[model samples]
Target: MNFVEELRWRGMLHDIMPGTEEELNKHMTSGYIGFDPTADSLHVGHLTQIMTLIHFQRAGHKPVALVGGATGMVGDPSGKSAERNLLSEDVLNHNVKCLEDQLKKFLDFNSGPNSAEMVNNYDWFKNFTFLDFIRDVGKHLTVNYMMAKDSVKKRLEGETGMSFTEFSYQLVQGYDFYYLWKEKNCQVQMGGSDQWGNIVTGTELIRRKAAGNAFAITTQLIKKADGTKFGKTESGAVWLDPAKTSPYKFYQFWLNTTDSDAKSWIRIFTLKSQAEIEELEKEHDLAPHLRILQKALAEEITVRTHSFDALQTALKTSDFLFGNGSLEFLNSLSKEDVLEVFEGLPQFTISKDEFSAGINATDLLAEKTTVFPSKGEARKMISGGGVSINKEKIADPALILNTENLINGKFLVAQKGKKNYFLIMAE
Candidate 1:
């Protein structure tokens, strides 16, 4: 597939350097994308650029995943509203290792001569003295040119404003490119549209220092149709690490994509080619309820970033909850499976003595439980038949709480309304 043209057509290519396509056609060339190692796991925001490299490699070129181990400690001032605290070396090292592990899942690090390689900027920057940094790499870009970037411009707009450390981020990042250009013969750098300023600085640094050629490419910053930033859930960022975000929630996140978003996202986020995506879009238009585009997007991303087995488990769990499966079928799930499926839901704990002491449903809903803040409100809901236990509707306020209603022998699934679910675990 023609990677550049494909990205352009799908609205993924936000910027590309002159002669970039010609350079790609010449021979096996190397391109790099820098990833911030500020977090232990990558979020969907990082996925867009990672997918860019994946597509580059598929087009018979080399891809380099640069861990921003050095830049992350100082924090990039370009996009933030406030200055960030620097991370300790121990934390930064740990985060870099974690981010490396996630990037390996998207790109082939062991295939072909153009195999993906992970490099940490800290390796080269660790012992480089401040004096040498200014004299060597930092001297290429003047403050006037650095201040022109939109990232720096926006930060300067804010009341808290920017810091010198953040102002120096682009120069530090530029050195990574110069380092790669001199050491590894790497040419192109790609990232979200926001990275244009920093990337062009890299190219400029190479021009002044090494007198070498380099290119820049950027993908469209993934944004929601309503203008909200993508990659965020109500809880926070949708992390690749299951510890921060569960596999079940992750699958659901994709499955919940909107009709308009699924159209573009299906192509950008998935390995499905132009023809396959078109067919899925046609099928979705034929019956949007089935959401062929969403399913394809979810399935491809789920299996790729996660695994077929995790996808299956998440799908099975989703079906049991939202599909034709009944409460009995939900009860049939293992305690572990049930917990995993509903992990994103709110939870509470109550003691066995509190549950067995002839406490009425209203008391259980408020005092004995933690769903509502007051017993009077719980009574009103139960009397309105708007309360449920294990999905069975409840109308009586005097109903007793006992082992009979508990799932897994010590827990009760309570719902105040159609959408509110509270898990009360009695020990």
Candidate 2:
């Protein structure tokens, strides 16, 4: 399939310029998608634009990733309620470097002529004086034209009104495109549908300033079928940074997707071909509860965004913790993997000599740990067979915790009923 057709099937195409397909078919063209440097890591919300660049590069086009170092400092007001806090230059530079490193994982920067390249708008905007911008780039678009955008309209109508900095955000972004177009010979700019005004401003600027023809494409902002914004969990954003979110938690986020969202997500997120997605869809129809789509989507993205080893370990850890894997499975984990997967599990810290010498089960589960909070509660729950240690029932209130009962000679897995888990670690 052609680039447009591939995107159409993948549910990616939202708006394409009039002659985009014809232009793409003639020769390899350069396309770019801008990303904000608001944080050190990109979130799942940023995947849509990344996928668009992936598709563009896959179709033999050069993909340029524009890091919005300058614009991000001002913040884009699309779908936001209030004025944004400005970022320091030091922080913005750090964010740009981090984002560029992440982008390298997906795009092929080593390939021939169509190799992907990274650029920063701050490079061009840093030295351009205020008077120079007003005379050169800002003269093309009228205030009336700027205020007509949905982003502007909402802010103007709302209680917070708008800041001159936020209002001028599009012009700054538009200048990024113009710079890329004139300097890099970049032909197309792509972003979410909400960026249409800013993108068109670039095209309009190109026409007025350089008498150049430039095109723009915008993809629909992904949304959950259940009506929540995509890329958010109750805890907050699903970050690409391992330090912010572990690979296991990241894997689980995709694995836990509802049936309806998974079906659509696989198309937009995965590089799986049309036929492969169809087969998975059929497999899903046969047994919707199996959730093959969610698993596949999760696995592909996890492996690509993280690593194959991470995905493999996540699969093993999930099976060990929740599936049929035995207690020996937990015993086999490296210290790091055990701690990573069990980061949120309640933990009790105790001296090695204390646990090794002798620790009473009831006291350990109560005074030593936050699991039960009291000796009476620990004893009552243990008597009812509701508390389990290392996947086995703990019934004796006087039972001792020792290396013999420890997994990997250092940790104990405590479970309360079917869901709650706690980890007790020897210091």
Candidate 3:
């Protein structure tokens, strides 16, 4: 399939300019997607655009990943109720570098003709003065045309009136497209559905200013089956950076997708053939409990974003936490690994001096931690075979836990029931 057809089948194509597919089919055109550098790390929400650029390159086209260093300073007002607090130059520069690094992971930079290229709008905008920008680039679009955009119109209707800095964002972004088109021979701009206005502005500018044609293609903005936002959990956005969101948690985010969402997401997120997805759906329907679709989706994305080794560790950690994984696995891991395995579990801390002298298990579970409300409950649970320490059933409430019981000399794994896990730390 060609680039446009591939996106169409994947349910990614939302809007396309009049001659986009024809233009794409005619030649190996250079296309670009702009990524806003609002944060140091791009989250899972950015994956669709990344996938778009990847698909573009896979179809034998040059894909340029543009980090919006200058446009980011004037935040895109799309889908916003009020103006965002602008980032300082130092912070914006840092965020730009971080986003560029993350963008590098998705596209090939070493291939012959279609290798991906990275650019920052700041590179071009830094030398151009305010006067130069308004005179050369800003004159192409009218104030009435800019105001017609839904992003601007909505803000104009709302109580938080728009700022000149933000209102001028589309013009700045339009100039980016013109700059890339004039300098890089970039003929197409791709983005999410929300960017339709800004993208068309670019195409419009290209036509009026440079008297050249440009294409615009936008993909569907991702949302959940329930109509809530995608890429968000109770904790926050599912970040691509392992430090921000661990591979295990990242894997879990997709692994826990609803069946309906999984069917759609598996296609949009993964480069899996349609046949493979259809087959997986068949298996999933046969035994919904198996969650084959979710697993496949999670594994592919996790491995691509993180690594095979990271995915393996995430799987091992998941198995140990949720499956009938052996305690030996936990024993073999270091304290750091153990903590990662039990991350977000309820934890209690005690001074090492107190832990040096043996403490009664009941006292430790009750007074020292919130694992149990009182000593009586701890005693009863221990007698009832419902309590365990390091996967070993606690047979005696009188048993004393010392430094010897501490895994890696600083941690203890406590269980109140089969699934309720707590971590005790001695520092």
Task: Give the 10-residue window scoring lowest on summed lDDT in candidate 1.
Answer: 320-329
User: Model 1: how far is 130 from its true place, Å?
Assistant: 1.3
Candidate number with the higher TM-score (1 or 2): 2
lDDT by residue (tens digit), candidate 3, 1-427 = 9999999999999999999999999989999999989999999999999999999999999999999899989999999998888999999999999999898888999999889999999999999999998999888899999999999999999999899999999999999999999999999999999999999999999999978999999999999999999999999999998888889999999999999999999999999998999999999999999999999999999999999998998998788777777677777778777777777779888998888998999999999888999999999999999998987889799999999998778888898888899989899
Supply the TM-score for candidate 2: 0.96
Model 3, global lDDT? 0.93
| Candidate 2 residue lDDT tens string, 228-303 | 9888988799999887888888999999999888989999999999899999999998998788899999999999
By TM-score, the candidates rank as: 3, 2, 1
How many clashes show up per model? 0, 0, 0
Off by over 4 Å in 3: none
Query: Which of candidates 1 and 2 reaches a greater lDDT?
Result: 2
lDDT of each: 0.85, 0.89, 0.93
After best superposition, candidate 3 residue 327: deviation in angstroms?
A: 3.1
